[model samples]
Target: MRDTLRVQLWPLPTLGVALAVVAGVGLPRLDGRIRHDTPPWLRDYLFGGSADAARSVLAAIAGSMVTVTALTFSLTVVTLQLASSQFSPRLLRTFTADRYVQTTLAVFLATFTYALTVLRTVRTGEDGRTAFVPQVSVTVAFLLTLASLFALVLFLSHLAREIRIETMMSSVHTAAERTVRRLLTQRQDPADGEPAAGDPPAAPPEPPANVLPLTPGASGFLTSVDEAALMKATVEADALVIIDRLPGSSLIAGTPMGAAWPRTGEPFSPAARSLLTEAASEAVRTGPERTDLQDVAFGLRQLTDIAAKALSPGINDPTTAVHALSHSAALLCELARRDLGPRLLRDDDGQVRVILRRPDLQDLLDLAVSQPLRYGAAEPAVLARIAMLLRELAWCSTPDQYPTINAALARLRSTVDAQNFHATEHGRLTELTARVDEAMAGRWTPGRTR
Candidate 1:
């Protein structure tokens, strides 16, 4: 939980403040020493440029930088708002996670701070005979002002491009694809191949008779589970542990994080039970919001949310919906080639220690396409794209996977059959359905996939 909290904390502002502090203290002092120690003539030639003029320049730049930084922040907030309204609020994570945006904000704020810090040191000595000018520091601030001006332009350009529908869809697609790959790679049984429909991995046997529930101290989404730590904890308690909630589950106070049962007939000791519970809690990490760390379904949900939002009555943008569906197809295609099984964690001796219910491939496929199709079935483009999506999944996946996609196609066909459509559109959908039906029947070239 501590590690999760650290990652969740926004670091850019802190980084900007640190950079400002370093520049503010270091540059001015260096410049002041050069002014006092350097030969007067050469200093006049270099460090001794007009103290009054440098001070005025630094002050102007400092004030202007403050205004520019404020403007940048305002525009960024507006962009975030527009993205949330137009796409899904879930997508705001992608925008916030953007390094370019964070760095841009950091640069502008840091530059402003640097200018203000050095600007205070530009004053001359009280005596008319002596003038103290940090010429080098003032020059650095002036250059920083120009760089910030350039950054302002870049941020505006980035803001414009980053909010486009294509960009949003692409970002979600990229994240989802990466997540699918990561989930598939972490599977324990490499040679088990993909799971056939109706033949899921056998469930671990029922819990031991004497069981104790372990409740978490905090409430949030379960971000990750340290399986190794959990297995060790189960061993120490001489018990079988079952995690009731999966990684993506939103935790509630007093809810069972999981339950443990003693391996032997003897019940667990209070001290042993307490230590076991503590270890279990430590193995699980929760946070305020869902992340993609061990939650692939969260990424799938993000795509569908955008598609569903686009198909809403207030915003009937079929093109965006179609675009989202297309990427959903891409992610599903990747998922098709991998096994989707509930993970059963075991100890070194091969005894089952933990059972976790992961989201199956079929569940993800439904999430990726269900709501979008329900909202978009009437639109010709969305209907066509969904049909194409089903065909691709049907063709690319294993024969056992065919049944699930075929059932989805059956659902689509039933809905299309019930809803009235224009003659041309109806004819187009009918043809697509025929092709998908053929694919589901295994007519496609074998060993070929996209």
Candidate 2:
């Protein structure tokens, strides 16, 4: 829900408009009282023009503010277009979630709303009423116009910086790092060959019979699951439920999501099967798009997309791809140090009640490395970064993660072998692969490689 609000452009600006309406209405009434208390010298600061003059001033401000607000919207749309075209479309969330852009829009719209609201209060002595001008209210609108101007300039400068490839990549890296830290826990070393504390025990062997096949209630991207509710249902039915889809996975209606079986190794009665199915439907949420709420691979996917887009023939920007790889390397190494796999939700009695399938190290490696390796094969720089990424992961990975790291290393090596590189380039890559070997063996040798 928070992610949804952050990625939207309306919430902040709507709030600003609401507040502006309140202020625009209430300030004019306050102006009637405050106008009498104004000191003679202070009168110079407040709007002292005639009612007609006040109308013209407010009218001009209102007209110009409307124009400025439209310009801001146009520029924002153009920026979104450029970002989507030049970079990956997934990056649109970053720009939309930006506080600066939202604040700027909020200020501009509030100014326009305030000006129009206050404009209606300007009165001339034509309808048997005394000439009246809310001096303080007019002054406030003028001040808002000035603020809108400054915000416009600052917003333009900010937009310029945001469109740069480096800025967008850094923003993605930071967000992905936050997701990694939040969702994953560091791997704990086992003592005396026992499973570490906080780690779920191995799942029981599959039951020979009485498994109930489950399907999704709706079709869309699986965004989140209500684990607590799912667990409650599992405990009530006395069954073990396994969810086959992760947060970023797509689901089709009436398609198998996973299975549930009675914990007693007996067939599920019709009532139990119906209860579990309803629970699964309500507990699992599908959305039009994926979020980082539970998906660890979403960030890596975005970074990889950026790299792949950079390596496209039309873009042909290998440097950006290499830069993106550097970001991916940091995230992959972080994941390597963390415990990852399917999540087991246990009941109050310590019985494993729910099984949620999640991406493990190998899955993440394939996500972070596969596409870049495919598209960036001919570029020596991109290849070197991929090898360096492997070496970094090797140094940080646990013993159990060695196989996955080694597999990725092999893929990198194969890609390099297929490339028609100069002798010096291939030699440098071969040496990097050797360094990766040393790192995997806990014998990281420090030396310069040419």
Candidate 3:
């Protein structure tokens, strides 16, 4: 029951001060007036006594007002602080509702009620000896009510600001969810080798008997020699070649089954062999690194798109957007580390030079690889953070100056081909390539709704 009431009264803060004043000041005055000029027992029981008692009651009422007012002011300050910390200054600037008007109304009603109570206490008989001046209490109550109304207005205004923030955040969250779902749906799956529907049928296999024999020079005298002679030759030679004719062909039982080719050239130049070995090793190492880089790049692109959507003026509150951007950035860095490894060293210009075997890049590799997934898993939160960061970055210059992911991609594209290490390092080299092409064609506008 308590929880239900709490939920039902969730908007209490919006009119809390006004309600407080009505109950605290008006109710007491009204109760007292219900039994005017009562007997001593009735006065003590219902309306209390003379002006002295009314004064004490008014003091209590004033104290409550002061306490609530102080608390409201403190709450306002605290809420503002929290909002500032959570949202950008630009977002905070949008909240400009007036609080004073509501507070003024609440104070006016409360004070008027208090004044009425005091006036009732001071009423006197027609003799004018020591009559209670109900009018005096009414006047005091009127003034106090005005004061309380003003306070209430201020308090309600703050509450309104909070409500506005929540509304904006809710809108942003809905927009972000929609955007994410759309992007995820639009993502292109990796290409697999599915044959085209119209491809010609595979050719039929040849019969086993159709196989050909090796060249005469390639074949050995084993085909013409006796098994005993071939065995003697094999024992004498470093290697022996043998060949066999198909079953339908005429071949003596003494003929060898297969032929061998002796290695004649200098086996392998040491330098050449080493080069071949190293090339193979490098190929083996870089294949997966390239893949990781591509995946990370795709993730980053999605993140950027999410951030851009969150930052749209209509969307509100970029908390999730900002988080997404940070996450994507971390992921990109991780992929770079995994693929580039020790080769990801910083050059003199502070650019990351992917020298595949360089040792100096280890630290950067470690830092870059460790971040993205830890923070990116919560897509909504990540996107919010990204949006906030983008807003902050946007404020530094004109909107045109905003450093978008596309811009970075364009700059990189201008200097390198799609096959370049940096380009390939990001998992979606093809997507990035497409983006670059689209950007060059003026099709990659950032603020486009989708």
Candidate 4:
């Protein structure tokens, strides 16, 4: 929760509030103390007008700030709504997390507060008393107003660019790439880290003598699992834990999360059970929706969902589906170069404590082509792109991964064959599938046109 609050853009406004308080209350007070030491030009520029004039300027800026904030925020919400209807609602997180939008809103709101704060400190110099003008502070407020106008322009331009489908694909693709990097770079074990991308998929560990049922405290999609924490708990309890749910899976309350097998073949003691439950619950985070942070399938699913939506009869947009496919194919190719297959988790003493369940090369390969093939069988362009995606994945995969890739290709052919299309379109799709199969079988040269 703490991490979410810090990273999520909503809480950023509170930071703006803090900044506004300082600028509103602190700056003017400081200026009052150092009024005589300020440069003459600065003082002259700020205090050339009467006290009412200065107060009027601050009041005008403060009022304008409110209008600007409202206009920008409304524009953002409207853009998001339009984008969601045209693209996908899953993209809401991407737009909301935009640093530029967040900063723009924060700065504008703070500018309003600063002007109001300084407005209170304004005083007329009509009396015999020396002028009490907050020359520097008022000047800074004017500068802030100008900066806010510039930010408004930036926000509008960014919103227009972000609403485009291609931009959303690129953002989602970059996020998936980051998730993959974290998966590779954040390995907890040196032994685990040393395996090559070509290593055989690790065999499933034998079932423990007795499986201790672990239940979840709440319900949501299991987005991430803390492998290191789970491994530590397993070591402390002297047991082996096997996860029942994958990262992209939804969960129900009190469901059997997984089973724990004791190393000594003893029953789970009360203390051990409590420790396991707490660690398991904390180690795995559940949220309303899936994120690419740890769940590899989540990212692939986003692309798949968008493609599926694009292929719907109401939309009938094959080009968007192909655009999404390009990223999905590239991500699969990137996955081909890394080892994210299921494997053993051994503790410091080399005692296997947990067996983690992660999507392997085959799972991704299936995801990369299945949805598009299913929804887009009749669209020659979509099928052609799927065939080409399969070819690229096949070309990049390890020698042993060919069978799985071949199986996926077979499924793509079956999908194309099942669709009722004009004879010419069917023949073209069939030809494309046959070429993809040949490429998978190593008969086609690398970089050959599909």
TM-score leader? 2
Better of 1 and 2 by TM-score: 2
Top candidate (lDDT): 2
lDDT of 1 by residue, 59-87 (tens): 78868877887787788778889889988
- Tens-place lDDT per residue, model 4, 209-315, is 46887766679988778888888888889888888677878878788878787888888898998999888878877888777667876677778778988999889
lDDT by residue for model 2 (1-450), tens: 887898899999999999999999999999988888988998899998899888898888878878888898898899899989888888888889999989998998898888889888878979988777999999998999899899999999998898899999899889888988898787776667532233533754464455787778899999888899999989999999888777799999898888898888777788898999999988888888877778888889888989999999999999999999899999988887676888888887877888898888899999999999999999888888888888888877767778888898999899899988999999988988888888887776777642
Q: Comparing 2 and 4 by lDDT, which wins?
A: 2
Worst 10 residues of 4 by lDDT: 187-196
- Candidate 1 clashes: the total is 0
| TM-score, structure 1 vs. true | 0.87
TM-score for each candidate, following the candidate numbering:
0.87, 0.94, 0.29, 0.91
Clashing pairs in 4: none
Clashes of each: 0, 0, 74, 0
Model 4 ranges off by over 4 Å: 1-3, 44-47, 125-131, 185-197, 443-450
Candidate 2 pairs with clashing backbones: none
What is the alpha-carbon RMSD of candidate 2 to the true structure?
2.6
The 10-residue segment with the lowest total lDDT in model 2: 192-201
Worst 10 residues of 3 by lDDT: 285-294
The regions of model 3 sitting more than 4 angstroms off are 1-50, 91-129, 133-319, 323-425, 428-450
- All candidates: CA RMSD in angstroms? 4.1, 2.6, 29.3, 3.6
